[model samples]
Target: MKYVVTTVWKHPVKIDWQSMRQTMSKSKDNPHVAEIHWYEIDETTHGSVAIYHSRDAYEANLAFMQEHRSNSISERGIEMFPRSAW
Candidate 1:
């Protein structure tokens, strides 16, 4: 199944495009990730829609993120809503 995830967060400071780009680029390095659509909710708020090849892939992504970039994500963690329709 295609695993879908959406996450929204507010930066502790104003949005940093340089850091955001550098961070999001990590998705390209993970084979399990299909794609990611990022949105700028406002100057400090951001969101993303990430699609993974499988549930395991999504979980792996979470582990990797938690290990390498947990600070970038909200303390609440990523939000997921899985389905086969995609």
Candidate 2:
């Protein structure tokens, strides 16, 4: 199933691009995850969103967040929802 995972984090002074890339690469290997995509938050927004395909979207999201936090980044999981028909 397709899931939308919303994450919010304080904009760091420097975004660790290399670390972020590595974290994402690792997330791709998660058994529950089939695929993932990211989008930057809009200027008026406070966080970013990642769309992922997974058998268990919630678990996939938790794993992603945990990995990021373990890397010394702080992030909050805002929501997880199945794809809307609309």
Candidate 3:
């Protein structure tokens, strides 16, 4: 499974990209995670699209973000599609 997560930062001042990179690196320890692609959309927003082994993996990662980066998140969304359908 794979998911595309989009987030808009209302409190951009609270973000530290360096710290986020470290967190993502640490998250790789989860066997369900295949890869993550991070993106920067101007100064106030950034997000990631990740490949996970299951929905459980996706939810776990979302939970991790909520716990660690709650202050920086303004809006968020998740998308999943069958690979063959796409």
Candidate 4:
């Protein structure tokens, strides 16, 4: 399954891509995250579309979000199609 995780942080200055990358690196252990693509919507908003192999992966991601409150997930959507040109 594919999920589009959209988040808007109040403090754009605190947007730490490196930290997020590090956190995502732990996906090797989580194993649900197949791939992730992040986007900067604006100065204070960003989003990520992730591909999960199974429901376990999707739930794990949600659990992680609940535990980590630094980023505010304002909107979340499931992706019907998974493809990219870049």
Candidate 5:
């Protein structure tokens, strides 16, 4: 079955929108990726939906994503802060 992942994160500080778009666009480099879309959840939050070929594909992507996160998001001081509205 296809695997779909939804993620939401917050940027306590200013965000580099161009870099965000570039990073997201790189998701297309993964052959297992079916579709991915990014959106603004609110003023400080962003969300994304990713569809993979299967659970296996999703799991594989998870590993790649972790490394990418460390190299890009983490390096940029981005934090996935807890949602206060919850």
Candidate 6:
């Protein structure tokens, strides 16, 4: 199973992308995480999408969110469907 975790936040001061990257780098030992990806929108929209592989997707998502306190996080499961038969 793959879970997507999205984080949104407003910084009191200008966000230092370098510091943020360093923070994320420290979580290399997190068991509930598989891959962490990030993106930014226009300006205020700053968020990260994390993909996790676990038997319990919901719990895994919650655990990841708990680790990061500065931002608001939301998690959703990804579902795929077959488009055609060969």
Top candidate on TM-score is: 5
Cα lDDT of model 4 by residue, 18-83, tens digit? 876786676556566667666666554456566677656677677775654423333322212223
Residue-pair clashes, model 6? 0
List of clashing residue pairs for candidate 1: none
Q: Assess each prediction's global lDDT (C-alpha) against the native.
A: 0.70, 0.51, 0.55, 0.53, 0.72, 0.52
lDDT of 4 at 80: 23
Model 5 Cα lDDT, one tens digit per residue, 1-86? 88887777777765567877987787788898898888887766787777888988877777877786566456755555432210
Query: Which candidate order results from sorting by TM-score in descending order?
Result: 5, 1, 6, 3, 4, 2
What tens digits encode model 3's per-residue C-alpha lDDT throughout 1-86? 55544433333244567876986788678676777666766454555666676777667666765565643333333222222210
Q: Which candidate has the highest lDDT of all?
A: 5
TM-score of each: 0.71, 0.48, 0.52, 0.49, 0.76, 0.60
Model 4: how far residue 55 lies from native, Å: 2.1
Candidate 4: stretches off by over 4 Å: 1-29, 70-86
lDDT of 6 by residue, 1-86 (tens): 66655555544445567866887786556677777765654354456666666646537556554544513232222112221111
Query: Model 2: residues >4 Å from true position, as ranges?
Result: 41-48, 52-86
Q: Write the per-residue lDDT of candidate 1 for residues 1-86, one digit (tens) a residue.
A: 88887767666667778887987897787898898878888887777787999988887777775565454444534332222223
Residue-level lDDT for 41 in candidate 2: 55
Q: Ranking by lDDT, best first?
A: 5, 1, 3, 4, 6, 2
Worst 10 residues of 4 by lDDT: 77-86
Look at candidate 3 and tell me the lDDT of residue 71. 39
The number of residue pairs in model 5 that clash at the backbone is 0
